[model samples]
Target: MRKVWVGILMFWAGLAQAEEVVIAALGDSLTQGFGLTQAEGFVPQLETWIQSRDASVRLINAGVSGDTTAGGLARVAWTLQPEVDGLIVALGGNDLLRGIDPNEVRKNMEGIMRAAQTAQVPVLLIGMQASNNFGTEYKADFDRVFPELAKSYDAAFLPSFFAGLSDGEGPQDPAALRQWFQADGIHPNADGVSLIVEAVGPKLEGLIAKIDAVGE
Candidate 1:
């Protein structure tokens, strides 16, 4: 009957809506796509990357230019909206740049992780390595903050936001790696973002899988 067909159509539509997965990327300028255009930034490239694999997902960009781990901690709760089913935490770059102590960065990052945990949202945490200029002890301590936190929470982890840029032969000079970065020698260029997305996209796909573990 016509009435039975209409009811079935609406039921299917509601089923489709319930399966949608929304994720939030919480970070600093890198996540904010700081020098890049609307389409060329990290979130857009990442979204394109995921959809190409036939996954349905939406990403919320919660990146703030010049924001530090402390700032991320402050804003994480609101970023985890009711619709957000997953998260990508990529803060601490600005904190490293400012020479903030690793302990403080770790504490702030832990706070963000706790907020996500409380919200019952899955997370994919990406981190940045410290420059040697920050000194041996500082570098070691800063480098450990991210992985340690990820381990504590059992969240997915990527050691560096720039993981795709490395040649993997060995350490390369910053001057040598300039092709991938903007003129500021800080934020990555569009081409650089492309490489990063290719490498980093898979890990986030895993997060999506975790969030959808219940169904669809």
Candidate 2:
């Protein structure tokens, strides 16, 4: 009986550990928590938020400052290790900044999603909106990349990384959100990350639930 009880306990412990999923966030500085302290960065705050909600999910910060879609594609295969249960893809901001051709951006994004798919890891893709300064045609093409690929791959999707900062009428208004940004008029400050965490946290919860449900 004692040996049987020990076996049962060990099984439970292993099951509990298995339920705690590891999620890798792939992106640029936004995911990396640039211009902010380690604890105040996006991944940390997001992890705290998940913990607060009683989730057993851990986030890996795979954000590189100033990385474009090409950069993310370059690193994604290695990012999807066997232990990584899910991924949050948030690249393309720098691609927009550089006005890279939307087709190229889309191709890179496709590569990333395909890598995640091949690894059998689920994905939560975060979109980036292009500046109107890039031209309306360009903005339209760039904006379409994320959602379209998400559908193609059956991946979860968010319309924009900055969706947390929006007032719901339209795209993020710079003047309205000026206080939330750093001096460079880019990158969210600590407080801004808090707000973003609030918005993205629920989606993350959904991902965790999916991971648990599928036993991934």
Candidate 3:
């Protein structure tokens, strides 16, 4: 009876541990929560959002300010550690800002995905739209990379990280769009972070489902 009770306790403990999922968010300044407090950053806000929905998950902020796809690629292998259950690849804005070749961005992104795949972890790729400063042809090329990579890798995809923040009311209504952004018109403020968390929360739930399924 004593031995049987010990076995039961051990099993339950293991099961409890299995229920706790860890996810890594790999990206640039947006993911890093630039110009925001630690609590106000994307990762913490996202954690709050996920926990509010009753998910037993932890998110690691692997975001670096000004990191391009190549920079993300360089560190992906180390980022997908043994205990990490899933990955969120949110990169390429810097690449667009710097006008790096779209093809090169695609290659670096592919490397990151392959690294995650090789580690046997699931991935969620977040897309970024180019600003008009980059021109139509460049914008088109840069915008296509995320969905293409997501489809190719069979990873989950979120079309744009800033989805709900931009209402199509046009630049005439700066307040609608500007309200969510910081002074630089780039990084999101605390409220902007909340909006992003709300927009991507559903997709994150889907990714969490995948992680749970894999664990099972």
- What is candidate 3's local distance difference test score? 0.87
lDDT of 2: 0.88
Segments in model 1 whose C-alpha atoms lie over 4 Å from true places:
1-6, 169-171, 214-216
Candidate 3's C-alpha runs over 4 A off are 1-14, 167-175
Per-residue lDDT of model 2, residues 150-171, tens digit only: 8998887778888777765224
Which pairs clash (backbone N, Cα, C closer than 3 Å) in model 2? none
TM-score per candidate: 0.94, 0.92, 0.90
Top model by lDDT, which number?
1
**Candidate 1 residue-wise lDDT, 99-212, digit = tens:** 999999999999999999898898999988888888999999999998999999989888889888886521257787799999998999999899888778989978887887
Q: Alpha-carbon error at 163 in model 2, in Å?
A: 0.9
Kindly indicate the candidate among 1 and 3 with the higher TM-score: 1
Model 2: what TM-score? 0.92
**Superposition-based RMSD of candidate 2 using all C-alpha atoms, in angstroms:** 2.1
Over all chains combined, what TM-score does candidate 3 have? 0.90
Query: How high is the lDDT of residue 104 in model 2?
Result: 100
The clash tally of candidate 3 reads 0
Top model by TM-score, which number? 1
Q: In order, what lDDT does every prediction score?
A: 0.88, 0.88, 0.87
